[model samples]
Target: MATCEPLYWRRCRSPIGWFEVGEPALIGPDAILYAMKKVQLIRDKLKTSQSRKKSYADVRRRELDFLVDDWVFLKVSPVKGVMRFGNKGNINPRYLGLYKILKRFGKVAYELELPVELAAVRPVFHISLLKKCVGDPASIVPLESVVVKDSQSYKDVPVEIQLV
Candidate 1:
């Protein structure tokens, strides 16, 4: 008759390391047992925190009401040399238009209709990329103006607006 001893022993490397089997006689089993105990403690702590709960219905919040065909101002950093040059590097002007809101995604994303020229460079923008331009108190135009005409003359207006 032949007797057989265990081929492997349970072992662990560190407090957060995985438990594995190792050569039975090479290392002490105490270190592996200690690591397993620490791992169990961490798991218990995580379970307790997940089970705890509190009511959040009393928290004050504001509801945003945005609809299709509403005018808005988008904050854009102009491309250097392409839009403006030198000394005017820091100017990121707001573009105003009556954007037709197509769809809403979650709380911070929206799909809007933009002009073909602007769409060539930037087709979509996040809500954080836009700011609502109300109006200038001293200006003749109460709201921000958007040029929607298809004539070639409209291209010149952007250059004029940038100068002032």
Candidate 2:
């Protein structure tokens, strides 16, 4: 009966013969050297492909650095069938608030001084989850002023009713 062996072993010139009893000396050091050369070639090819992939990724990568006390907007992801920050819909804002950076955790993590309404969320977030907030800082509104319910919803109270 013929036995099945891997194609790589066959390429490596390793003895895989049926019916013939081959001695150890039959497979000389040359065959072993050939196998080692094949392995080295595979490793070199793998390294070349990996470097190519990394170069492609580096092209799209952006360096983000934020100082302490800098204001940044937190990127919000709206999950299906989940309500966040009082709303979840097509019109929901993609980014939320001017959160102040409390501290930097390494190069890619930061601790933000989040509002009271966001106490449920972890203050420390990845740099990718944040965007630098530009323009006037006074535009930020205090979360305490907004009456957000436990269900992340708020009632729209009419401050004035003007009859037209």
Per-residue lDDT for 52-82 in model 1, tens only? 5322332433344555555566556566556
Residue pairs clashing in model 2 are 86-152
Model 1: residues with Cα > 4 Å off, grouped in runs: 1-65, 77-90, 94-98, 133-164
- Provide TM-scores for the models: 0.39, 0.64
Task: Write down the lDDT that model 1 would get.
Answer: 0.52
Stretches of candidate 2 exceeding 4 Å from the true structure = 1-26, 81-83, 86-88, 140-164
> Which lDDT tens digits does candidate 2 get at residues 15-76?
33312345444555677677567657766777798799999999988999999999999998
Error of 1 at 39 (Å): 4.3
lDDT value, residue 138 of candidate 2: 77
Question: In TM-score terms, which candidate is top?
Answer: 2
